[model samples]
Target chain A: MNGKEFWIYLAILAGSTYLIRAIPFAAVQKKISNVYVRSFLYYIPYTVLSAMTFPAALYATGNVVSAAAGLGVGMVFAVMKKGLTVVALISCVTVFVTDLILKQGI
Target chain B: MKQFLRGVRNGVPIGLGYLSVSFTFGIMAVSAGFSWWQAVLISMTTLTSAGQLAGINIMTVPGQYAEMLISQLTINIRYSFMSVSLSQLTTAEFKGIKRWLLGFFMTDEIFAVAACQREVSTKFFAGLAVMPYIGWTLGTLAGSLLGNVLPESVMNALCIAIYGMFVAIVAPDAKESRSLLAVVAVSVGLSCLFYYTPILKELSSGLAISVCAVVAALLGAFLFPVKEEASHER
Candidate 1:
């Protein structure tokens, strides 16, 4: 917590983080050719995205109801292939309004 | 140059999302007693939400170097998997120094975008990474300097936008492929299971996410292996 400790801590954290990220690239120098390995890598994105999204999305906002509404709206737009910004804004607005409505009813 | 511009354009929303989230982080950092420069520096160096927050928590407690190291290692090790996966898609010439530089900005958003591409160009990845990086740093600076200027209502609402964007990224693919749908379901199911189950609920978020993703992805690979022609298909 002093200036010196802060810098040192940040360095360690950053250094480790950088190493963790960069090591994989250094190790996996060439493109993978194995069928199963290739398939696993290809599926990584979607699965990671899914794992990060659900339940978290429903709890991201202040209330479950508003977050769910926002998620539904966001998914609708996303499925329709709306732009990222559009989906983001609309979903936020949906949550905002839903929260407002829920607040007033209470 | 064109690819770079396209990356920046695609990065616009991610930058916006980072601006708000890091702004929140900045407020938290300031409250946690970090000076403006320190808060900005942390954001610049770490570029990860969970790791930096946990780091800040550890910093407050003091003398928990081991704890801090373990926290960061566990929280961020997923990036290694992402980088390895991305390396397979990147050009063979994208090695040495270029790989190190690219690795710096391989945040989840950037990786998601870059990995979706047919060809991962260094130029495009650079452009994609820069916007969010600047947004993250500047947002931290603004938050630390300005404090909580935004209305509470707005900030609360904005919390879900980034998640919305994530849904936006994956929904299309899940719709197109049954295998992808199965993977999504499995991941969500496992995540929920981890979250709700009494004992498993104690598991760290990083580990839970990694387990869910890896397990679901392996199942997907086995159940629905990409055809030779469609292996590289986005």
Candidate 2:
């Protein structure tokens, strides 16, 4: 908690995190030949993002209705192949507006 | 150089999204009595929102280094999986020190964006990592220094920014291929099952996500193995 101890703690924390990312990345060189492994790797991105997004996104804005409004808007733009900034900014705006509508009871 | 600039451009939105999240992190850390520099240091070094948040909770007065170690490892194990996936996307010579340096910044956003590339170059990956680091550190400094300048509702709204970007990355890919659609759907279904069911709900967020990703991807691999020509197709 003090200045001195903070450095050590940060080192341990950062060191642990760095190793997790570094080791696997360094280990897996040359192309993976196995079909199952290759396919699994290919699908990892989509699956991880999907799992992280759902349900969690629903609760992100603290209000389910507003969050869903944001998520729906984001999904619409994303499916349209809009850029990341466009989709994300639109979602934020949607959440803000939805929260206003809910609070004002309009 | 062009690739590097392109990476920087692609990183801009991610950096913007990070500003909100790290700002909240800054507010929380300062409110907890830690100084602003401490929060900035954590963001700079660890570069993981959930892991750093967990670290803060575990870092009591006495400092449970053992507990912090385990908790951080648990929360960030997915990065290991992500790194392995990314390794396949890099050039043959991208190894040794470069792996350690770049892997240090391999947050979910950077990984998603980098993976979208056919192959990641060192310059490009380094450039992609730059702004998020600046945004994360600067945002924390601002939040810690300024306190709650942003409205609560506005801060809450910004919460969706990262997730929106995630959908932006994955949805179009899913649209391109039914197998990917199945993977996303199955992952989401399993994720909800873990999130909602009483017993499974107790699983930590990181573990729950890993389980969903691996199981769904495994099923995808078995049922819909890609032909050799399309193995690297995304």
Candidate 3:
């Protein structure tokens, strides 16, 4: 798209995104006392993060075997309390190395 | 100065993480026939992964406004949950424009940073949001402009950036909470089931991931409940 069209598209996107984010704030500007809603909100982050991260990490490889290898190593490091950088590096390395070793019949 | 530096420090890893993933988005946009500026503009405005990806899909299938809206809403519907959770954390005095503005930039990383803070000041959260916001937008712009010059191999590798960011977010928390161990376990297990099971493998990647995550977390919470002390603050 040209510059004018690009700006227009950006405007549309920015407007929509802002609206999606703004609606929740608008709704809950007042205190929400519902026990069930509060409890549900409490677990939202873990659920959201888990949903967002797990599948990609496990199925990084199209096949289950490779994916399991990567996820297995990742979970081990994650359980060990390795920080983000380390867990990521270890997972990627594990996937890469496993693929390499399996390829080489080692 | 201290607070500003803290924001920057908190943002560095997020910034670094965004650089690679946003760069990939940049490349994807351009390769899909969008101009560099068009790609950059999307990044600048949306500053979201699912939104931007949906944008690309819309661009490819122009004239499908309804379809685009549905796709975008489905992907971003989760943000509402994040917003609700964060709304509770904000002080009563933080109502009005400030809350609205800060709420705009509430991505997962930004939320994690804010949630983990000892004091969730509006100013500090805004500062933190600003750092990553600027980094992500600029990174996308730069990547779009430069993607043509980069090799396919390098771009492929950069595809892993989002995974890196997830690692960073979960790693620190997993260290603090023994309960999180089950969270990780269930997620991996469910993810494996989805991938390996023939019937379920037909599901879309995004939906599959979302289902696995939510179910696994719920199950994990039940099986290995967080002790009262840790649950108190969380």
DockQ for each numbered candidate = 0.78, 0.81, 0.33
lDDT of 2 by residue, A1-106 (tens): 5877787788888999999989898888778888888888888888888999888889989999999999898889998999899999999999999999999999
Q: Give the Cα error of residue B2 in candidate 1, in Å.
A: 0.8
| Order of quality (DockQ) | 2, 1, 3
CAPRI level of candidate 1 = medium
Q: Tens-digit lDDT track for model 3 on B112-198? A: 656555445666676787667877887788778887566543443344434655655666576676667567667667776877799
Clash list (residue pairs), candidate 3? A84-B168
Docking tier of model 2: it is: high
iRMS value of model 1? 1.2
Q: Give stretches of model 1 more than 4 Å off.
A: none
Displacement of residue A65 (Cα, Å) in model 3 is 8.4
lDDT of 2 at B24: 89
Q: What lDDT tens digits, residue by residue, belong to model 2 across residues B26-62? A: 9999887789889888888889888888777776555
